[model samples]
Target: MMSNQNSVQSGFLPIPSIRRTVSPSQALSRSLATALVLALLIFVLGPLVVLVLWAFAGEWFYPSLIPQKFSLSWWSTVLSDSHFGHSVLLSFIFAPVVTILSACICLPAAYAFSRYQFPGRRAMFIGIFATNAFPKMGLYIAIAGILYATHLMDTFWGVIVIQLMNTVVVMTWIPAAAFSAVPKSLEEAARDVGAGPFRTFWHVTLPMARPGIIVAMIQAFLASFDEAQGTFLVGAPNYITMPVQMYSMVTNYPQQAAAVYSILLSMPSLILLLLIRKYIVGGYLAAGFRMK
Candidate 1:
């Protein structure tokens, strides 16, 4: 106590320089990590940035980093084209139809897999999981051959079937997880409180699983709308959609027109993604794989 009174007290630490500082290696590593993330984002978004630039570039040349002139002529040409309009119409029609059908067919199946026990259930789940584990091009080819034999190839319905095939795995796997994640006790509580099975499910179960279902639906819609390889193989000459049309534009139309079309093609998915961004995270969709 006597020494304490005689001690030299400072208002701040003498080593203030080192107080909030990281070691050199940590700082370097943090800087490098930030740089790598920026590089990766640039790598991914670089082409998209160029597309936006090229869409408005009227007189870009090899030496120019930016366009020498800018104009809205490309947007006009793309918007005015009959083929672009038709492709848009077909995409809007087909994507929604595929999403609805997938929900109807797969949502019940997901619920069954989640809530019921049956013989061969595990094996059936594995089979469904494995459908998306392989490269889809080979499957598309096999399906195309089958479609040809079945007299379904090159038809609108055939195209729908092809797109729907892509969606089955997503719809089943994600919603299965979502449905399985719902607490059994809450469902039971609903039933015990005079709720019927359907009412219990509609009120208690469905709301809890809605995020996963929405994620599944969004994935299905985008898969159908953006699918090019299957659509190309099955519906090329007869039912050319937006993605398939992009192939033609790349080879035939000016870069600017293709850029404008690319932006337009991307708008719907982007808009939807922005609106319901929360549901698209992996947690809602991937937390349900331990079904016994």
Candidate 2:
């Protein structure tokens, strides 16, 4: 009887041992997952942290993980200067203009591409995408010559026109995806309810595409805001944008340039990204909704 009792006790003890064994494994898995997340965070945010550090550093020669001293002198200098102010104002003005122009031009084009089966739709998309392959610098001379001939060279409108062409491509792709995500059934239902084609589109189609449109607008705005080569190549003498101003400042005030303009340049993008991050992700996932 005692031997049988001992055997039963042993079995119960083994069950506890098995439970104890799982605890360590679970703990180890949690630790590994934490480590992996930390690694990814460092990989993504490390450069941005370093950039922020360097921007505030009194001098930017490497050899130290941290700056010896920090100061707001550079920020002060940038804010006090009228030139920086003007450049900032220019960026704010032109970025919106570019965004608006891109939206106006791309909306109809995106609608057509998404809704209609045109003869050369595929070819047209291919041709448009092909333009991205050529280096921007390669087109500079030709663009400059054309602008000069058209009396738009060295003017604000010239920069706007040039930037508009590039911005429209990106803007169109986002909204086209958004538009394509809208349900055909929705339009059909609207039509069945006695709505005209224009009324159905205005009421049913556009509201669904709003998230994508917002994302596209933000993208186009950032593109024009940070544009360096096109703005430098086309904008001349007195027509200066923030990036151009920052470039010029690099020669004379490298630390100040990095500190002030880099921070300023990043703000619009950062704010917009934070605001629309959810919408962008939602739009991407909801792209399959059109099939319904």
Candidate 3:
């Protein structure tokens, strides 16, 4: 009876768990990864840190780990500049316009590439990407000359046209891949249920590919938002976007002004990414692309 009772008690007792130890290889790999991450953070953030310091610093000089004095005068100056406000407005206007137009142009092209096979298809994609292969300066100069000849120089429409160069090829490439990854059977299933091509695409394929399309549009907007050289050359002295304005400010104004502009340029993208982080992650996953 005692043995039986003891056995019963033992059955109810919990077992002690064994802890897993890190292997030497795993430990080494972990150390290397941590070091690499730290290195990357420092490399990228060091200059940005300095820029921030300069933005608020009054009389910062050498050999100081921190600024001597901080002031909001630079911030005030940047805020008061009407040209800066205009630049921000222009970016807000042009970035979305560019994104919309690029989507319209790319969606059909991407669908065609993914849905059909034709001669020189691969060559055509290569040609599209090849346009960006040239140095940006040379490309911008060529584009600017065309804009000037067409009398589109210094116009909003002209800038929008030039911004297409930033978006079209890449957006098409991504959506094409995403579309190819989607199974054709799904579309056929939709059709068998009496749905037309447009309805099938709208109801079936588009939702499946929404993640990739969202990512492509976001990328296109960012490309236009950060576009400097092409916009500066094509829309100079008339319609300056935020990036072009910042490029000029960085060269001629104090570091503080550059810092202010940097923050302004970055805020919209950061906010946008935060809002659609799930879509970005989903897009990468749906496209079978690894984040790292």
Backbone clashes counted, model 3: 0
Model 2, residue 264: C-alpha shift (Å): 1.7
Candidate No. with top lDDT: 1
> For residues 17-123, what per-residue lDDT tens digits would candidate 1 score against the true structure?
35335457678999999999999999999989989999998989988889999999999899999998899999999999999999999999899999999998889
lDDT of 3 by residue, 1-35 (tens): 98887667666763411111346667789999999
- Give TM-scores for every candidate, taking all chains together and pairing residue i with residue i: 0.91, 0.82, 0.83
In candidate 1, stretches whose alpha carbon ends up further than 4 angstroms from where it belongs are 1-23, 288-292
Between prediction 1 and prediction 3, the one with superior TM-score is 1
**Candidate structures ordered by lDDT, highest first:** 1, 3, 2
lDDT of 2 by residue, 1-292 (tens): 9879866876779886576669999999999999999999999989888878867877655687888887677787777889888888988988899888888888898888899998988777656665566677777767899999999988989999877867766676778888888999999999999999999999999999888888788878888988888888899676788888877777777664566667877787899889989986775534522321
- Clashing pairs counted in every model: 0, 0, 0
Ranking of predictions according to TM-score: 1, 3, 2
> Considering only N, C-alpha and C atoms within 3 Å, which residue pairs clash in candidate 1?
none
Q: Report lDDT (CA) for all predictions.
A: 0.88, 0.80, 0.82
